[model samples]
Target: MGTASSQLDPEVTEKVSRDVNDLISKHRVVIFAKNICPYCHMAKNVFIEMNEAYHWVDLSKRPDGREMQYFLADLTGQSTVPRVFVNGKCIGGGQETQELYKKGILQNLLNQS
Candidate 1:
């Protein structure tokens, strides 16, 4: 069965896709998140502790938030907040990000760029 995002208008979906891609391309690290989500906070804290700067979109605060989340689900195969990208690649979400941080892999990913 098709997902809800698949039911979205093609034009809107395309625009959101392009806009998101542009954001990802423009930042070395990007977190697509919702403000109240603790998982999102955890992910953000990882970068903060590393003293690395990142760009993050608070999906809950945007008019297009729901569409963005749907787009993320389509792109990453998961529908969760704190969808993180390093160097324009999906590195999974909060707990996954925390795992990478624990293993010291996240830092390495950051340093590569």
Candidate 2:
């Protein structure tokens, strides 16, 4: 089955894009996730284990969640949840986060301010 249409209205896409950009710029770590996603929990747990602070948007609880997901896919080339960004760059999702952590590179990225 094909993915759902990602063509949101220009104004809406612009607004969502701006909002997402603002979040990335304002926070050292940002995770775009769905509340019930296990991968989301796994990704967030890494930060918790390291005692690091992060900002997360639970898209499942937001009115524009689907749009945001679509926007994230467009930005990161992944339509999955737990899209984690650190140092204003897409580090990828849960599995990728775990991999980075194991490689010790995730710490280096977090150290950048």
Per-prediction TM-score, please? 0.96, 0.93
Give the Å shift of residue 6 in candidate 2.
Answer: 5.9
lDDT of 2 at 78: 90
| Candidate 2: C-alpha RMSD after superposition | 2.3
Off by over 4 Å in 1: none
Most lDDT-accurate candidate: 1
Instruction: Write the residue-wise lDDT of candidate 2 on 1-113 in tens digits.
Output: 42332467878888888989999999999999998999999899999988989998999998888888988888888999999999899999999998999899999999887
Cand. 1 TM to true fold? 0.96
Whole-model alpha-carbon lDDT for candidate 1: 0.92
Q: Residue 60 error for model 1, in Å?
A: 0.7
Tens digits of per-residue lDDT, candidate 1, 1-113, equal 78767888988888889989999999999999999999999999999998889998999898888998999999999998989999989999999999999999998898887
Model 1: lDDT of residue 34: 92
Q: What is the total number of backbone clashes in candidate 1?
A: 0
Q: What is the lDDT of residue 76 in candidate 1?
A: 92
